[model samples]
Target: MPSLELKAPSLELKVPPVAVMLLVALMMWLVSLITPVIALTFFVRLFIGAMFAVAGIAVALAGVISFMQAHTTVNPTTPNSASNLVDSGIYRFTRNPMYLGLLSMLLGWAVFLASPLALTGTVVFILYMNRFQIKPEEKALLNVFGEAFLQYQAKVRRWL
Candidate 1:
């Protein structure tokens, strides 16, 4: 059987990860601006706000952990260039903790905004990551680590 070779076109002109993140956040804020006022009671809004705050903190912590583990280049689709394959800590749970973290943060923002449109933007972000980031990274990891990558994939989900 022929080995499946995964390939991605050169992304020479893509936006940086930080820039993409900021753009997503900005978009969420824009969504909040257009949201209609609701009749939610003050205490209920406060409770929801607190939930969002907690989610934001959790996402921020995950981002910090991901940054610490990021000893290699920022490109996820180039596992061959990685100094190490991080499979411990949060990595053991989900292959894309950083993306998950960002998603959680965006979800928190959506909640804080009390805007359904902002939540929809968060869903769009997830879809974008699955297509552009996670899929390419999975392919690159399989190419670089072969059986090891497959084993990890079996043990842990792409997201948790």
Candidate 2:
């Protein structure tokens, strides 16, 4: 019988997700300059964008608080430093609330920019994080937490 082997992702966790988000935001700005703006009122855009940003901040903070309460490392770059498996609080719903929060912020930025092209940054961020950040983190967490991590993974969606 032949064994199935998974090739390691080349960029796995090499770039910090926060940095990627910033770069994507810059790119989004450039793209927005070259694209037509969406037809949205200024007040409408401001309100919608602010709502998303606030929600993102809240969600990300919840994840951080959960990790802090659990005495686990919140640093995504060093998943091995995590001392505990946190599946409670916000973690019970989404496996990567931090990343989802960042995504929400990007969405809010896109809406504020009112450029359809700016939305592409959100998509790019998701792809990059999934490949380079989240997947690697999941592997490390599984290794650290064993079946417990697997069970948590099964119960929670990666990003909601």
Candidate 3:
């Protein structure tokens, strides 16, 4: 007799995080087209959105820079390729600053669109990234870095 095995639905690291972010942005735009905008002045929305966008860019860039300095691969799809574990710079705050930064940019896009419905994309993006991208990356990292990775995970929040 053959043993029966159950299989889980997988989305693990198949899509690039940036591509996911862009797709979410497109969905947000589509939602904005049909939804009513929030009652805010254009300038106010632009200023706030721009602030979020700038902050997101800075945080994401910091993560990339830290990886570069450590001579590690910044490729999220290939976490196993990392040469060294990075615990400095923005990484000290959130373990996944790049994802957080992308989320921030999506939030900025939602604000700029002024559509309440568009904000839903942020939630979707977070859930998707958490399940599909980050989980797999963390698993790979745990394999590569072992105890050190566990210690880092204990110290840092996944997202902030």
**Candidate closest to the true structure, highest TM-score:** 3
**TM-score leaderboard ranking:** 3, 2, 1
Give the worst 10-residue stretch by lDDT in candidate 1: 7-16
Q: Provide TM-scores for the models.
A: 0.73, 0.92, 0.93
Task: Summing lDDT over every window of 10 consecutive residues in candidate 3, give the lowest-scoring window.
Answer: 2-11
Q: Which structure is stronger by lDDT: 1 or 2?
A: 2
The candidate that wins on lDDT is 3
* Poorly placed runs, candidate 1 (over 4 Å): 1-13, 37-78
Collision pairs in model 2: none
Tell me how candidate 3 scores on lDDT: 0.93
Q: Say what the RMSD of model 3 is.
A: 3.0
Ranking by lDDT: 3, 2, 1
TM-score between model 2 and native: 0.92
> Per-residue lDDT tens digits of candidate 1, residues 10-50?
54214444455668879988877877745676677667767
Candidate 1, pairs of clashing residues? none
Model 2, 46: alpha-carbon shift in Å? 1.2
